[model samples]
Target: MRNAPLGIFDSGVGGLTVVRAVQQLLPSEDIVYLGDTARVPYGSKSPETIRQFAHEDVRFLLDRGVKTVVVACNTATAHALPSLQERYQVPIIGVIEPGVEAVLADPQAQRVGIIATRGTVRSHAYQHALALRRTGLILHATPAPLLVPLVEEDWLDHPSTHAALHTYLDPMLDRGIDTLLLACTHYPLLVPVLSKFLPDGVRLVDSATTCAEHVKQELTKLDLLAEEEKAGKLEIHLTDLSDQFEDLSRRFLARSPGRIMRVSL
Candidate 1:
């Protein structure tokens, strides 16, 4: 089981952030990443639909022989994690809990700002998770659904992106949040642009990085860490393949994903 690949799935290309983190930290552990590009945005979907999609994703990964599954999509994590875990024998991890741990780690974060997709905000997953660990938390949640398409378009630093950021984040900034949580995996791609807009004292908390840390911890605790002396391989599966997604792969992995397989999920 130690040598079996770690499975990761997201609603779309955004989950690559989690992939990058896992690869960086656990170089010897193989990975299988599936991006449901055909149904890119799960944020607007109903909970039942999201849960169904997530179940299919888990089945696809499990069929490929993964020992663990990481639900990298915040929306799916919010609504589908419990069902996925209940039905599957493999251990499952979600993005929300790891992100909540990150926020609580910072003592200076009295007022924390959360920016994610419409569904994630509507589900109140982050808010609920944080409430369990902390008391009297001042939280501001905002939905920046536009950012996903912008990042997919590779408009990481466009003037239009700045305008959108201003509109989505201005209220959170006004709340004097010392820490801002990038709740969506795709938002990490805009960190350079997003950081520029943040006040000097406010720190950006990237859930992907923290989630990856949690992955490492979990694997280590279960004695599932790969023992291979050399770097592990990465296999990417997309529901639909395209030049744009191929192009974005470079941005996500710092190189080509190397032989991507287009599969319908």
Candidate 2:
């Protein structure tokens, strides 16, 4: 079981951020990544639909014999994590709780701002988790649905992307948030652009990185950590494929995603 690959799925290439983090942290563990590009932008889907899609995604990964599953999509994690955990016997992790834990780690994160997809914002997963963990936390969350398309389009430095970011974050800035939790995996790619505009003291908590850390911790606790010394392998699967998706995958992974296969999930 230690040699089994880690399973991760997302609505699209955005989840590659989680894959990249996992690869960096746990170099010896193999990974199987499924990008549901055919149903990209799950943020607009209904809660019931999101849960159904999540179940299918997990089933696909489990079929591939993964040791664990990571719900790298923020919207799916928000809407379907509990159900996924209940339905799957393997250890299933999601991006939301790890992000909330990251926020609570900082004693100074009194007023925090969250920017995620519409579905994730609607789910209130982050807010609810933080409320359960600690008290007196002032939270502001907004849906930045535009940023996902912008990032997927590779418009990290585009003026329109900056304008959209300002439009989403300006209100949070006005509220004097000390920490900004990037609830979506796709948002980490915008860190450079975000740093250029955010104030000096505002901290950024990236869910992808935190989720990877949490995965490592959980695997260790479960005695499932791979004991190999060599670098791990990665497998890329997508429900749909396109030239744009190929390019976006490369950008998200910071390297060539070799031999991407199209699968019907």
Best by lDDT: 2
Clashes of each: 0, 0
Evaluated at residue 188, the lDDT of candidate 1 is 90
Residue 67, candidate 2: C-alpha displacement in angstroms = 0.3
Tens-digit lDDT track of model 2 for 34-103:
9999998898999999999999999999999999999999999989999999988999999998999899
Write model 1 residue lDDT over 1-265, tens digit each, in one string: 9999999999888898999999888889899999999997899999999999999999999999999999999999999999998998999999999999999998767898999999999999999989778888899999998898888888989988998999998998887888899999988988888777888999889989999999999999999999887788999999989988888887888777888889987
Question: TM-scores across all candidates?
Answer: 0.98, 0.98
Q: Each model's C-alpha lDDT? A: 0.91, 0.94
Error at 204, model 2, angstroms: 0.4
In candidate 1, position 220 carries an lDDT of 94
Root-mean-square deviation of every model: 0.9, 0.8
lDDT of 2: 0.94
Candidate 1 ranges beyond 4 A from true positions: none
Candidate 2 has a TM-score of: 0.98
